[model samples]
Target: MSAPRLTLPSPAKLNLMLHILGRREDGYHELQTIFQFLDYGDEITFAVRDDGVIRLHTEFAGVPHDSNLIVRAAKQLQEQSACPLGIDIWIEKVLPMGGGIGGGSSNAATTLLGLNHLWQLGWNEDRLAALGLSLGADVPVFVRGHAAFAEGVGEKLTPVDPEEPWYLVLVPQVSVSTAEIFSDPLLTRDTPPIKVRPVPKGNGRNDCLPVVARRYPDVRNALNLLGKFTEAKLTGTGSCVFGGFPSKAEADKVSALLTETLTGFVAKGSNISMLHRKLQSLL
Candidate 1:
């Protein structure tokens, strides 16, 4: 008989605010950021295999199977748990690559959480998140599946319930490399950390914006266009720019106007990731 299949949502996230506090000797930046999920993102499906043979049926044109976060996460969990089981993975890609929306990281987290359930590993969130940190700084937030305030290379997380607003997100035609943005000499490395609980309204900003805007014309154009409608902000080191609206109707109006010039979409922001909600329902 065929193995049971489980499909799950892999939600995207926005860095509501990102501040670079300093650079570490380890070459990772010391960051202070707020992370919140979007109602929209990619979807993943998994089928278990008794034999140890990890595989991803979906193909991402430029990303190799070995390098894909889904594969890496699955492998990490398998090794850590010494599980004899493997998985057949498939993804329905929707989130734009290199958009700073945490697409890859979210996928990795979903795989770890999903596999843990399927394989019956029963790892706690803290343990899974620690394993996720080895994959990427953004992975833990997705693993924890909550909106949070992050510091110290983006692994230190403190949950926060920020306003759940509707956002009009514009996707630029070009891809912005996070590495290129961080390595640039012009990028700001020191923004005094905010020391307030729940982070006061509009208390933070992305320091990478100045450098990102100067380097990617498509990103700059999208930002300029959206800024005309609302306070457009760059999420993380972005190729995507977004602005929040008080309602879905308001966000849709802005998205309609901008879609004429750029590719974009509208989604409701959430303090709790959709992935966690689904997992909870299953339990």
Candidate 2:
């Protein structure tokens, strides 16, 4: 095992609220969203090599090796940084794909960050984050190591510290296609814009929830189920629903029952993102 035994985490995110404001000249939606990092997520490990090879090992069967975001992210980093080492990336994926949780984007962000250190490229957070934005809108937030309020195609970020930590009853189920949700003409694109100001000290709304539930029964069911336990809301577009609890024990109890009823995970919310603190620890 001569390769650098590097391990990294790609944490899942929750959109505390999603507000769709309008459409852009680029055909992208203008929006506002509050991003929160989860305690539960996926892990990845990679060792450096000079063979110019990128490899990914996972339980996820049938994904094309070249198409895997982790591999592609590593290659992109290597190419742009002109690093001399190749990477063998290993992803221990736990987050649901296509759930609007930003799992894949987080994976890509982790790849970009982990390889920078393993390859000893010494790029700063801002540089890596800029590169990450090129990969995906969500990637930049993860790379910046913050749970943020995002706008302007989601690259613009302003980190906010939630007044208190939260408990999340996150539904894990069939992945939903973001493209489908975004392309739906029925999707809300005309919600009035609200200026971001410290999250208004309370729960906000997900503008896409109604549209998503109509198309995905799982989400509708989950929403109904979760609403009884706590005020649950849909995160991002679809496939995952979340409820906020005031206490961890209460959330855990619900999570245990939810685990039996539905396949999902319960996690704590943090004011500080694990990815940022994780990297800071290394230095």
Regions of model 1 farther than 4 Å from truth: none
lDDT of 2 by residue, 118-164 (tens): 88998988888888888888998888877788898788999877644
lDDT of every predicted structure (CA atoms):
0.93, 0.80
Q: Give the per-residue lDDT of model 1 (tens digit) for 1-283.
A: 9997899999999988899989999999999999999999999999999899999999999989999999999999999999999899999999999999999999999999999998989999999999999999899999999899999999999989889999999999788899999999988887888874957597478899999999998998888989998989999899889999999999999888889979999999999999999999999
TM-score of each: 0.98, 0.94
Clash pairs for candidate 2: 49-86
Of candidate 1, the 10-residue stretch with the lowest lDDT total is 195-204
What TM-score quantifies how close candidate 2 is to the native fold? Answer: 0.94
Report the C-alpha displacement of residue 240, candidate 2, in angstroms: 0.9
Query: Candidate 2: where are CA atoms >4 Å away?
Result: none
Error of 2 at 264 (Å): 1.8
